[model samples]
Target: MFGNTLYVEKIQHALEQSNFPATPDNLYDPVRYMLSLSGKRIRPLLVLLGADLFNIENIDDALPASLAIEYFHNFSLVHDDIMDNAPLRRGKEAVHKKWNESVAILSGDALLVKAYEQLAFVKVEYIPELLRIFSQLAIEVCEGQQYDMDFESIDSITGDQYIEMIRLKTSVLLGGALEMGAIIANATLVDRKHINNFGVNLGIAFQLQDDILDVYGDPSTFGKQIAGDIIANKKTILYILLKSKLEQEDTQEFEDLLTNKAITSDEKITRMKNLYQKYHVVQEAGELKGKYTHLAYESLQKVNVTEPQKKELYSLADNLMRRTQ
Candidate 1:
């Protein structure tokens, strides 16, 4: 079984070896800078793992597809950061923050084009399916973003709607990456579908875990601002659950906490967290995460591989679910 560590190293090396054009510094420099930030390469790792599961003869053959996913992922991040007006990424200046917004926009577009170019390197037979998955995911990502923006102006959103939003915005890419790898390995249709489901479910749980961490994770290790979601009223799962459970009388307090500009950010977080505990939303969110995590494991089990062969993926899912930061 190929371990994640080995695959991570391989992905890292391949990304390092990739060459970008030198001239037109404004355009290419941000692309280089964004890649250099190097967040967890989880999406590409899924691509390699999906291919490996089917006993693909040459892992190297999948490198282009794997890189394509990474490029697309970074491209999404660059634009998301700009849209979010996020100042930091991986503890460094975000692309739009480092350069100007216009440059960040152009560079992000370049990354998206580069992703298609990488896809062009795949075998001709695999290209059609890969493009289908990639394009569908790309469109869904945009839809998810639009929905997310729509939610900002709306007062309330249901739990199912939040789940669907995260599924499109974040989970599908992970699933698509796995499917692309399965295509490269020439996996059976059933196996491909099962593995894709596995990645998608795991992604849902992963994002819910992030929701839990945002309020509760230690600020020092959380990477981003702890309780940032709460402060922003970002409609996280926890927030949604809290809204669903909160007493009608307390809804005013909730609104006050979010709208009261006079309170310190820490005070707002503490009060909201206290309310979260009072309504048991935090525990409820954890249980929901566990439910999806279990579903992910079940999906992985349907992949037609032996139990021993699934151990590494099992371990990967376990570590991701339990991660504190």
Candidate 2:
């Protein structure tokens, strides 16, 4: 029930309320702005939920590590937007859009460093695991970014590559976040691994759902334009899959749209979406998302969670998998 999740929600709300202006007045303010943006606070919520699963007293003891999770997530987003030249984040101006790339770059770096500063508050016993998980996630995120950039230049990409890219770029952090929470809660190793797998499969389902939404979500609810990925020629799950499946003329039209730098956002989005429909892109993406969702639920069922708790968690997973945007 929502009552059970209220505690995690409160921790997230408190974390946001505790925000303060960045120091030195001239620096790190941009990173601060990115942090201040109205993000869903999902990562921190995961931390609290992970801790609560083990009946950990005073989840606040995990607050610093939880904050680290958020800081690192925002830091990655700041740099990611710059690389993607994305103009908006959380439905507002992106950090790179608000400031010059140099400032954005420096501030993003500071955020990463500051993430470590807060992470130091993890009790001495948790330091090694924290460092190991953080380092591995950091590296994987970079690898994912590189793979994404690589996709821009390649003529074609495989479904496997697309899945791995999203796993690295988007899912690893989710897994790491829950694992970090388990580590802080001092859960059994089996439980920690299971929870981590839960996060991992959940992430795959979440990303695949996003891919499905990119072409089919309601425009108003989706925030961003539908089929925006197709317009950008981004190597999304749908795009790569459709590449090998669409008719030659259909493929050429999609490719031609991408080649045209002059196409309006609305026009490009419309054409790509129309073609996606003609080729059954949305259905294929939906099926892939379902596969991941089933896998995620299977992983969730393997944990020690009581049925009622499992229902609550399943509700969350259902929400993620079924989101419009």
Best by lDDT: 1
Tell me the tens digit of each residue's lDDT in model 2 across 153-236: 897788888889888988888888878878888887888888878887789878887777777778798777667777667778
The TM-score between candidate 1 and the true structure equals 0.96
What count of clashes does model 2 give? 0
| Alpha-carbon TM-score of each model against the true structure | 0.96, 0.89
Error of 2 at 302 (Å): 0.9
Regions more than 4 Å wrong, model 2: 1-5, 8-22, 247-251, 260-278
Per-residue C-alpha lDDT of model 1 across residues 173-290, encoded as one tens digit per residue: 9988988999999999999899989988999999999999988887787777788898887899998988888899898999999899998998998899889989999888999898
**lDDT per model vs. reference:** 0.89, 0.78
Q: Report the Cα RMSD per candidate.
A: 1.5, 2.7
Error of 2 at 86 (Å): 2.2
Clashes of 1: 0
Instruction: Write out the backbone clash pairs for model 2.
Output: none
